[model samples]
Target: MTLGLPDHLVEPILSRALARASHWFALTCLAGALLSALSLGLTYEAGLLWMAVLSVLAMAALLVTLSLRPTVVLTIAYLLVGTGGTYLYTTDLLGLPDVFPASNMFLAALPKLALIMVGGAGSGALTGVLWSTAGFVLAETVTVIAAAEAEVTYLPDGFTISACLFLVAVLLLAGTARRPHRAAQSAIHRAVHADQSRLLRQDLDLRALDLNQDTTLNELIALSRARAGPLTENLSGSIRAALHRLRGTDWLTDADAHRVSHSPGADAWLTSEVYLAIERCRDRGLVVDVIGDRSALGRLDPVVDRELGLAVQQCLINVILHAGIVSAEVDIGGDGGIFSVMVMDAGRGFTESETGADRLGLRQAVRRRIKRLGGSVTVLTRPDAGTSVLLSVPAAAPAAAPDGQGTR
Candidate 1:
């Protein structure tokens, strides 16, 4: 059946395709049969022998082609029908008294039409059309040659009408084949769009969760712990600042907002995580004198912002708790490709080697974090001298800078 057969054949794509094609073939065959019967008038000059025999075999082939059987079986059925039809028209193998010479043309075209309409469906609509067209052409040519050899005169009009009817069958099967693909494409598009919308909503929920932890809830806890008398100036300031942030677009992350760059550095101060860290340190009662270009901190990706933010926070904490000074300076600046921050304080500093088992925070939290980000951290100090902890990370260009940090 299959020229390229393996031990156990399995062709799902071919099977489904042929199944669809068979429907078209079946309908077209019915149409061809009806047209032929009406045009020629079912004449049984005594008995219905040839028509009965051919119908049984063609119908059997049609059934086999449409079945969920091996592709080889379908191929074999097509071959048998094609050869049988050609042989019947040319020979006396299935000879009967009721045979009409003109009807031989119909016999010639029927086998080919059946193969294309039935077997071709397994391959696909395009293949069905291609093979069906070829079959019809071959049928017409063979019929003309056989008719001439037998001196059988078929009306030119009858031959033309029969060919056109079979052509309609080919078109019908082709349309059926494309139907499934078009429907599947539409369904896939809908599924993708739905999935995107669901993920967008989930992202917004996560951003809200991060904002609650980062600002609003923390301020609420601080306000709840205030003891006695009127509210302190620092607590009042914190409350007001928290309220301002909540009312504005500050809590919204980049994923929930659209960026249209109208001018360079437009919202640099508001978006700077470095400035935010400095402010947080100030709230904790450390006098942080920030210097240098602050805008360089604006466009960092959220992941980088969080990594760099935590590293700088760890540095400042070390300065406030161990440096024996309540004040420090944070210098933020960058060249076109590298952004840097240095927390400096004139306090009792230690040797770099002193950051051992007892001082794991400096070695692991600060140095290791920046190192993982493909950046470096440097410590410049000796005992009784000022300590400067500088951290640097790669910066994306000004134009394509990230708009805002989102939740990690």
Candidate 2:
């Protein structure tokens, strides 16, 4: 029913289509006036003819400007200039109000048609009706004044009156229909929000399970390696931390807790896609030095964000299991429309050929996920040298604010 376009696009598309149609209609009226004048041999009034020509040109310029910019002020200006032009052109063609009926009233109707177009330029149906009504009143007032100046009896054009009434009826009907459409849209949004919330809860449960299992196993291994004598200071500290983590209800790690204290908006970053991976690594006792613009990660699509985050988690997991070091660096940056994250570890690296097919961490999790999202992964490593895995994806452009400003 939406023609494969998003709901938000329908209104703007309709507005633009109406505006273009109105522009063409106005231009067609102007052309008809010019042709009518020529056919009637009105070239004898050289000054009036030239004035009509200039008015036509000015109206054309205003119409084009209105189409391009489309502000309320510009719309008002277009209506004023277009009304004046129609009056001038009509007087030029008909000469006097007495000759209006003799010319089939086409010349007199030009002003009304120009006025009706104001409705088409409006942002919505109700707004269009208000603008069109104002334009109709102004055009009628001008017509009456011009008729009085000529000392002839003036009568309202029935066609113009009927057209205005028809437009009002149509707009009112559209306004009524819009209420139900908005209600439907709200229902759809609520459904989508509920679904997203459910998915988030499931993801959290999985993270909590992984964290609990990893902490318990690591702590048990430490206890098994202890001697018969009293526990070492490091061993005691590790055991206490493990117990606190197991007993604690809050899922936030040390860094997340510190960020929440200083910045109220830190929740957005803390719960961000890639930060989950960083939090997991920190929980496992790996020192992750995150650098560059962290906000850039938020500009990615949800699927890309999730996949990239999982890839980062796997890379860090590899470091903890195989890399002989306990520290790593994750550099996040964006350049030339590409969002990049580089995970580097100063641990003993291995050759690509030496990696077994069963080791799916790099091949399946990291590289494959990034590749599926139209991104690329680069690995630079050698025997005994540090490993660097760079993941890059197409970065989405930041959305603009409603008031024509850039949003943070």
Candidate 3:
């Protein structure tokens, strides 16, 4: 059995799938109209030929927009154009008694197909159904008006009505099925968390074993020296330190305990050079909120860590100097052996082309340093929009020595 999609991904995936299906359906309808017209030798008529050419061009524009930059506004605009084109095409065909009943029905159904596509363009099932309903009302109104002008009997095509109803029903069913979909998503999340917890425990166990081995060796040395005579001050201090380690009393101080308890990955936060940069920014009256998987920073080697820290410092400096905002956010995450850092600020953003060549803060400091370490920097900004700078680097590994040996 296949488990359903995650809760967060369901709507987007559904919308895209529906949009693709609707595009194909509309294309099929358009193709049918063209083929029917051609087979009847009506392609030679000036009025019908002009309508066909314009309709094809309009359809091509709609297809291109849907493929490149699909928006709800553009979808509605295309639907209106399609409805008008369908009415004109149908009116021209109505004057010809030679038109087959199948061709007539197909021509009448074009506007309804366009309206049905509106449903697929929505961000969610409910939204799509509402948009589709509005399009249907508009299309039917236009159809009735066209038939009256032609002085022909107007009968709603059964196929178009059924298609409209089927689309609405599918959307409603999808809306109602959200509860079970969420449950499946929750089950998957729980399973993933359990697996990560198991891996974390194994790693912690290995670290503890190493600490214990070192502590045991120091304790034995102290005890052997003490058997000969009273312990020296250094030996006594060593024994005391080992006892503290064994009891886990000195693992974290009170301040450190609080920090770790409040911050999920305080170990890396407190140890990484990024922490130093944050403190510096804090001193300069910049409020930086650090979040995400901060512990992922621990995977970076010293050289990579230092470079990343400096790059982040430069990003924060730019936010303070140019963004006109006193606050920023730094997020850390990693996936598939790549560590990522994002610095974001909601302030005045500048266009890349507007900046002078002398503005080297970002080009030299942020981008070049990360690039030297085989990393990438991406900057996203526009006038009035916020700025987000992403820095990504490979995870830690031993550096190559001059003699062709790998050294940690």
Tens digits of per-residue lDDT, candidate 3, 1-408, equal 233444444556777777677667767776766665454435545455457446645764675576456687787777777777676666665545544333326566764576565677776788878877876777677667766766667777777777788888887776546655455554654465567779977876776787778897768966865657766888889888888887663444575445545454567677898877876665455779988987788788887788788889999988877786778999999998899999999988999888989889899888777777777899999987989999988886443232323222
RMSD of 2: 22.5
Rank order (by TM-score, best first): 3, 2, 1
Whole-model lDDT for model 3 versus the true structure? Answer: 0.71
State the lDDT of candidate 1 residue by residue for 1-408, as single tens digits.
Answer: 112211111233444654565555545654565444333334433133355346535655555544545364555565455544544433321233335545344443554455444434434444445545554555456555555655566333354345445654655554454433444443454455467778987987887788778789989899789897899999999989888877666556563343432334547754666666675665455668888876677767666777788788888888866786768998988887888899999988988886668887788778877776667788999999989999988876222123322211
lDDT of 1 at 131: 48
**Candidate 2 structure quality by residue, lDDT tens digits, 1-408:** 121322333454566676677667766766766566554445364456566667767777887788787889988887888778766765565564244543226566664566666676787777878887887887777677656654545777776787678766765564444444544543554455567778977876787888778898899987898788987999999989988977764576565445546453245456678888887666555779999888777677766677789899999988877676778999988887899999999998989789998889999888877776777899999978989999998886333232323222
Report the number of the highest-TM-score candidate: 3
The global C-alpha lDDT for each of the candidates, from Candidate 1 onward, is: 0.60, 0.72, 0.71
* Per-model TM-score on C-alpha atoms: 0.33, 0.43, 0.49
The C-alpha RMSD in Å for every predicted model, in order, reads 24.1, 22.5, 16.0
Which of candidates 1 and 2 reaches a greater lDDT? 2
- Stronger candidate by lDDT (1 vs 3): 3
Full-model lDDT, candidate 1: 0.60
Clashing pairs for model 2 are none
- lDDT, residue 251, candidate 2: 71
